[model samples]
Target: MDPQTEGHTGLGDWTPEALGAGRVLPVVSAPEAVLSRDGAEVDPIADETVRLAADLVATMRVSPGCVGLAAPQVGVGARVFAVDVTGHAKAVTVHGTFVLCNARVVEASRWKVGREGCMSVPDLTGDVKRASRLVVEGALPGSGQVVRLTTDGFEARALQHEIDHCAGLLFLDRVAGAHAIYQRKVYL
Candidate 1:
């Protein structure tokens, strides 16, 4: 792990070098078996897990408008993911870039329907209901330190979205009905 990222107190310092300079891995599309099965819980400090975390962040950065990504999206069935909602229009509490492992929602409230799309399901978007306020518990990629993250609005939604990916769920699985789904009009 890069000391600059590991020693930094802020979440924004994350860079590809932090995890041994992770490379951008190809994202697998929907219907792929890896995206349908729950990801395996991973050791936060494992070499492979750290590398995957780095790669996830690297991949998310390259994808336009993508605020989060999961291991399964890259065909790795591990409960690891990356998120960075820094400058999103709807973001309320940005954490910059960070990776979490085996994350679980500990608290959720203020539900509302929001439009969501995924790299794995590039052709569609859906109005899925998610909590606007949330608390998640998970371990950090390199430190193996468990953390309780409190966030709301878009950041919360993004976390839930990526968490769902780790659990083998697509936004398509959360929509109220077919009518709630729409063809993605914008590529970005």
Candidate 2:
């Protein structure tokens, strides 16, 4: 697949083999050094990196209630993440499914506190203060062209959360205090 055109519409065209979509990579849990260590930027157009990007999207789709997944969470020390906010109750600005490599928040504003959880840090949930609006920029996995995403509300929060992972930070790192953290609750 051409990396340049893969995710121009947010969600890429790759799918699981059965569905003819993409590959689903394993999710790494907390306490793993990779989850806490900073990620290095890689050539987005590399075949390995492109495959990793597809794996991120696939893993995020299969995980219940997951809106995003970062590369480090999959044991890759590269700056990449996949996010899809469709049908999420908390989502306001939906971006469908998209992968961002070497992502960074260029602008953020309108702070708000929201409860958050992570696939890596599954044992805990926390109330995190984050910007409600954000302008994020990153390279497209296959094409290496820089793309900017303007989003607000839940999508903004999800973007920030995943970007934090790329920076070797977790929502736990952003929680206000001990009182802000709680045991994760299962929805069903």
Q: All candidates' TM-scores?
A: 0.91, 0.88
Off by over 4 Å in 1: 1-17
Each candidate's lDDT (Cα)? 0.88, 0.84
Q: Per-residue CA lDDT of candidate 2, range 70-178, in tens? A: 9999999889988889999999888677888888888899999999999899899999999999988787777676677889999999999999999899999999999
lDDT of 1 at 12: 41
- The C-alpha local distance difference test score for the whole of candidate 1 amounts to 0.88
Report the lDDT of model 2 for residue 83: 88
Please list the residue runs of candidate 2 whose C-alpha ends up more than 4 Å from where it truly belongs after superposition.
Answer: 1-21
Q: Any residue pairs clashing in model 1, and if so which?
A: none
User: Quick one: best lDDT, which candidate?
Assistant: 1
- Give per-residue CA lDDT, model 1, range 63-108, as digits (tens): 9889999999999998999999998999979877889999899899
TM-score of 2: 0.88
